[model samples]
Target: MQTTLMIYDGTAPADSGVPRTGGVPLAPAGFTWPICGSSCGGPLQFFAHLPVEDGVLSVFVCQNDPGACESWDATSGANRVYLFPREELQPVEAPATGVTLLPATSAIRTHVVTLDPAEDDDHDELAPDAYDLARSGWKREPEERFGKQREVLGSLGGSPSYLEDDRLPACPACTDTMEFAAHLEEGISAQSAMNLGGRLGYVFVCRACREGAFLTD
Candidate 1:
């Protein structure tokens, strides 16, 4: 069965040139850089800094040795998602080199959508490069359902919070069940987008463990 979901997209903020890989938090005080998984033994790649009504959502991922580290496994300790309080938010220090932070702070509106075949069939069954396979048939259709809202994150709703349910990941830190944190799709352009391997990246966070996970499919 093909389940339909309404997702949203909006303009991204201008780049501030802060290197995201192993970058500091946006908060002015009382925050530290999130630790990458055991695979890297170093800092994770800063993905995005999304601001919402509640607070700022900071994201990080592991791009080092992506082809070898089971990078798509949510529990692989390759990703981190943090929801920081806006009151304590501040600018982060940029690094000298490497990929920098993504521009997504100004999420203005939402766009609702539904797919013809759910776009992710055969989800439970493991397939090589399953994430890419699931989205292979994607195309821009004129009939795409659109809506407007103030939602930034959590605007899209579905299994595992607007993503495929089977793609739900566990917390690598505690081996406990994880919860959906955000849904990352392609952006308007390359400079300010989440290049999620041409598929949707589902971000999960184990609030209990203070750990995060990421997967794309």
Candidate 2:
């Protein structure tokens, strides 16, 4: 299976327009910073800025009260995903209060990884999850296992890792099942990672409707 992994490339300018996590989000003019519509009702924390084929995927989640707001559910209103046009996007002004951004801006670079099906003799024993396999095999050196795993910012394109069928989100605009867009890891460093309560973040989008969804698992 072929999986495109997003690797950390150190710090980047907040509005560099490159694929990254943290930093201020770039949006069209008149764009207002998203606020959590769930329980906390505070400004949502910016999670990522991902450049995709058609546009950029801007993500946000409520950090005001993690578990209390249900940011892990796509339709809960505590999280949001937007597919913004690549051009004409400007850095958005952040709110004065709430967790609106991470402590550091993390740059990302993509690496395509192909996992040979023939390499595993126990393939039949377990259902293969491409994202998990790719992440486990991302080490640069044989002994770099755990350390290298931290460098994985997430992935660009691939099936959702271990996501259940029913958990797939429906596009808010058209009510159609959204296509999997990306998977986001917490981050490279504990201090800079988006607070996900130790779970993985999932992004989905409906190209036809230009809508997106965010959830955690």
Which candidate has the top score in lDDT?
Answer: 2
For each candidate in the order shown, give its overall lDDT on alpha carbons: 0.51, 0.90
Candidate 2 regions exceeding 4 Å error are 121-124, 140-147
Per TM-score, the best of the predicted structures is 2
Per-prediction TM-score, please?
0.58, 0.95
lDDT of 2 by residue, 90-161 (tens): 999899999898999999999999988667444577788888878877865655534378989889877999
Which pairs, if any, clash in model 1?
Answer: 8-111, 20-46, 26-90, 158-162
Q: For candidate 1, lDDT tens digit of each residue in 1-217? A: 2222222234433443221212345764756555556466555667665554455567777655556455566656666677666675666664444344554433423333434444444444653232232223234343543322112222322344335556666666787777665566555455445556666667666666666667777
What clash count does candidate 2 reach?
0
lDDT of 1 at 115: 42
